[model samples]
Target: MTKEKESILDVKLFKRLFQYIKPYKGVFFGLLILVVLLAIFSSATPYITKYAIDESIETKISTDFLFYVVLMFVVLILQTVFQLLFIYYAAWLGQNLVMDVRVKLFNHLLRFKMKYYDNSSVGVLITRAVTDMERIADIFGQGLFMIVRDLLAMVVVFGVMIYINWRLSLIVFLMLPLLLYATRIFQKYMKRAFEEVRNEVSNLNSFVQERITGMKILQLFTRETIEYKKFKTINERHKKGWLKTVWYNSIFFPLADLVSSISIGLVAWYGGLNVVLDGAVSQGDLIAFIMFIPMLFRPLRQIADKFNTLQMGMVAANRVFKVIDTTSQIDDTGTYVAEGFKGDIKFDKVYFSYVDDEEVLKGISFEVNAGDTVAIVGATGAGKSTIINLLNRFYEIKDGVISVDGIDIKDVTLSSLRTQIAVVLQDVFLFADTILNNITLNHPEITEAQVQQAAKDIGIHDFIMSLPNGYHYNVKERGVMLSSGQRQLISFLRAYVTNPSILVLDEATSSVDSYSEQLIQNATDKITKGRTSIVIAHRLATIKKADKIIVMDSGDIVEQGTHEELLKKKDGYYKNLYEVQFLQEEVI
Candidate 1:
């Protein structure tokens, strides 16, 4: 993972993020008005204090003192109201903005081809969707608007200080160069540190997700200590990344404080001398200048912090935009809609590769007539499963035509093409959901009775009923609550319930027990009755009844015929495979 160099203040990324804010311009503008009003009221406070001291207290004018008090009170109340409004509106805008980005990111992910998931990390995507989005929201809710308010306050305060006495203002401005230099160094170091932190966070997420997902593998192989050591290494890297940010903060913030203190001390020393020796500055002016020093420096310090928030938000936006800007989605310019496909499928000189030039399927051609049952058998990496992938257009073939009912699959809308075909893959994936919901996949049109009937038809209804909640049973994550056999049975019920025009079972029953296999074979008979079916199987005997058997080896079809017909070919590939693979299975 080579890191891309990012600008500390990425203007382009911020511009893209602001597009999400466009929809809520009214609220955004309201926030801006509130920020300006808050700044005006805040800066007015010191001036009111100065006037009360000089005009009312010094002159012993009771009425003038009371009037100034009332005015100050009013400004405080308005400032409080503005602060409240700012907090509320900022939250609302940030939440809505995050919602828009999250929805768009998810929809973009849905458009990605299966190859994207194959190459991308699930945990990293999860971080982008969940964690990175929250960071982006902070830019709106806590970072940008606060920065505006602080900056406005500083500008007004500085103007007031200069109007009171130019010499003191110049003294205060002299310390700013030191602060600015320190901030520049801090920003450069922190930007690199923060980017590193984000990368490490993503790395940690990916590692933990995979480790947890494969915990069973680790434990079974007794590699827990090894994995723990690996986790520690990643965790330490994450810690180091964060500590770099901390180290810069430790250096920069104290430097900012030292400069702020020096500016204030200079103002006090100079203003006190003028008041005492020359009588040029009033007591009120001295007091007001001291108050304005903090007011001026506060925003500068806060701006540095807000700049951090802004920088992080830009980083997050860059990552999220990268995902949204990806052009890897399947081309869906196809306007053809497949309605009630006739179940005929054909592969014409197909060629494909998961990676460039490393073909997985090479000029492979086959056909299955409507109502025919075809079985594919091959050793691992022999392109048996790749055929299933190509048929469904999960990956596009570099050179080929896959047609359903004589229409190129690419010409038809993906939704319609996929809706008519159901695949029960070898590794069944079930959500952490109720059994019924998993079966119907929350399809509104699939009624409870239909699900019950489908389960009964598949001969697994009794086994399901044996559970505490039966169809309502929670399968937990990835159906971990159920046995592998039970999960497979549920997958079968899910596919059967869809009642697809074409069915594909890719090594579906390869790892199940005999009882599960019997139920699967029985369900297979019911499900494949009138549909175009393609079965990729390692257990050759299970597919012996298939109308046609295509034997594959190293991305080429070496044999094709009915089971008995292929058996009669003496030293044929199918016969050799059957003896070497199936006979060994029988012996086991």
Candidate 2:
């Protein structure tokens, strides 16, 4: 994957991320106030100690020292309370913001055109939605507010030190420029390193996800060792990406520590000399100045760490926004709605291509009247399935029109268009859910009674009852608990339960047992009884009962007629294909 250069601090992206916090502004602003109070109380403790040493301890006044000690305790108690409040509120705000972001990202993904999934990696999208979102939460939970609190403490500490003795303060301030310069250099390198790390993480996710999903294929082909080597190579790259960040931290953090130690040493040496030579700085003031050195430098060091969190959030936000900003969604501006379509589908001189300059359908035209069962047959890559894709508007046709019930499909709302049409593909997908939930898909309107009746009508009700749990049986991931043929039966029932006006079966019965094929054929007959049905099939013998058969080859329809009508033409393309493809099936 090519890396894109991203700014360490993207103001616009941060502004967008902050918009999610706007709804919870009460909590956000409350956290801000608590952070400031925490800083003030923490800074006050050092001054209290200084006062105790100089006024109480030096004079040996017991009452005065006791009063100072009590005041210091009050300050510490308030700081602890504020710190707890800050932690709680920050966590609440971050979790709420991430929840909102994740929902929006998921909803946005639902709107993307099917073409986007065709080209994008499911694993990378999962990373953006899941892992990247967590990093963004860290920006709010641990990053921004902590930076604010630390910086405020540092400023307050510096002000107190200057007030105690300006000479010592100036000596300490001299080390600031060198530390700031080192921080800037560290930020630059860490930003690039983090970007690479995120990219490698995404690459690794994509690789592992594909490998796991295709493990059966790899092992069947005896490619386990080969794939293992490839995985190690990718894993090594991911490790190297992370080590770059570690290498930067190792060098920069110790250098920061060295500078901080030098600053403390300078303060101690200068303040002690002033106390002895001129009696200008008291022992308590010298002690406080030494304590203030850590307060100043520690914040600077922590700001570097918090800034890393901030930068990572910005990177994650940029990736998330890229997906949300994509315009590759089906246009749903058409306002047309009908109570129900009559299911008269017309493809008039339609042209389509999945890729540019490569036409899959060349001026294909056909019509299926309401209640007709038309089957499309062709060899692979003949654009047979592409027809089904266009009818559902999963893709946009390049030219011409596809209409249903005398209304151009493009002029109707997507929801209205799709709700009336149901498709069952060759490869069925089932969620890791109960058989009933997989069929109903959580649609309240599709009740248990409706699903059972539909399954019974399709002759699969007994088959489902034969299972261990009947309709409640759990079909493990991708319906792995059931055979392919059983999965197809469930799909037919699912499609039937929708009571769609139009039904599409795209090679739905291929590669199933003979008994299962018989069941599927029975289910098909029931579902397509009164609906306008289009079937795309490779096994032409099964579609002999279709009212019309459309033969497609290389982006063109070579023949169209009833099965017997076409078989009468000895020299015809459909007849020739039937002899070569289905003559053996007829003999059997």
Candidate 3:
């Protein structure tokens, strides 16, 4: 009932689909040639049938009939050959077109920002990538070819009918409007039913993916029965939706058949009456008229079916275009970045909000001199992460200038600006790839020795060597094959390999065991030796060696000091955090 309708299937879909066939216009010309040949041969068939019925079988000694029969067979053979090639070319064009579309759509998806990924569902995205692409292929391979073949056949059938007997042809075509009205009615029902079917299928796919990914959580909570019920609900909905679609399609075919049968019956009865009562036409002419009746409506019927398929394909196009329609809010409009930035960062009265009314970062100002190590400490949701995110230009600032080396960040190309910075996030993400490859995600040309050196610096090289494949060892999705500490070690290596000018680590060791955390802290101290760094944590021990500690509360900086200076101030927030952390550890 609720539809997020826009022109997702606008001129763009047609333009893209057309561009795919631009190289194959020769194929289009060939298809047209085949259509015309098939039409001429199809029109000849009724005459061949009429001759057999009224002359050869009725007269019993016609030498010319044998020659006509042989000629008919030759036409039949030639048409079959051309039709086969027509189908082959159509299929080739369709397969390649869909493949191109999939490649383009996927690459476009990669260019989008984090906010785009955050708001979308994985199941819907996956469905667009695969199932919807298949639908467009169907349109090219079968739908377009079938409609063309049927239409040309209709044109030939009509010319023959009028030449044979216009009165009967006119009477037979009276039922055409009835057929159109019937399709309009059925299409309304089918579209809504099929839309529901697609949605249900998407739900089932998402349910399976989530259950597979979260099997551990489900088992931990002992919710196998509850999950089973949820799966059954989605599966049954999909089943019911499909059954409804089948029911509609099944009735649809029969309705067309009934209309066709009635029209054919009327033509037969009238043509027979003219012969019996008035004798106004020859036996051969009556036979030819009878043959033309089905030829006319069969194509018309096929045209309806292909139109139905077109509507279905358009529905899929609409879904795929939704992703294509989404604009990247964080747009890059500048030339390449300046070759060397001094890493002098400033947040000048910065403001940002995820939503219109709820400000995530209120008016705040800060400065970090080039090569300085600054530690940010705050309560949860104190906008510490927001400050680092803005500096990297990940989310565009709502107001004020965030500058790097005194140049507005918005003026630098996003890719160029990011190349000089490295971020070590609280949540470590590693691909299902070799350990060596994960470390050098961007700097792929780096040697194995370089990878090992970075890992050894982080105190993780020895552990990687302990694995069966050493540096070549494979990590599972999200590095699930490794322990929590191993994942953090790999993430740190990924950052270090970049040898970035600016380093920002956000709770980088939050989930690691104490032994690994200490190793990481020591490694980080070395990595940040000369680079401008913003280290966000409240662990107290991690920030003790920082050149300056920034204490923030509710989007405002409350204190700024060195570790010993902050500890000397008994009433400061930094001292309170340090006391709480030390006391908690002592209790443990």
Best by lDDT: 2
Candidate 3 residue lDDT tens string, 1-588: 433333222366566668777777888678778777878777887877677657676667687688778877987898789778878887777788788878878988887766677677677788889988888787777777778888888888888888877887887778878877876677677767767877887788777877888899999999999999988888999999989878877887788888878877887788888878986655766788767767877777777677567656667776777777778757788675766667798888888886677787777878889998899988888889888778777777789888888888888888888878889888788989988888887465888898888888767778789897998888978888988877877777888888788889886555678888776776777788888989996465667667888888877788888888988997888789877774475466
Instruction: Quantify all predictions' global Cα lDDT against the true fold.
Output: 0.88, 0.88, 0.78
Cα deviation in Å at residue 319, candidate 2? 0.5
TM-score on alpha carbons, each prediction = 0.97, 0.98, 0.88
Residue 465 accuracy (lDDT) in model 1: 95
Going through the candidates in order, what is the number of backbone clashes in each? Answer: 0, 0, 0
What pairs collide in candidate 3? none
| Alpha-carbon RMSD to native, per candidate | 1.9, 1.7, 3.4
Report clash pairs, candidate 2: none
Per-residue accuracy of model 1 over 106-151 as CA lDDT, tens digit each: 9999889999999999999999999999988988888888889998
- Candidate 3: residue 287 lDDT (0-100): 80
Q: Ranking by lDDT, best first? A: 2, 1, 3
Give the winner by TM-score: 2
- State the lDDT of candidate 2 residue by residue for 68-129, as single tens digits: 88998888888888888899889789989999999999999998888999999989999999
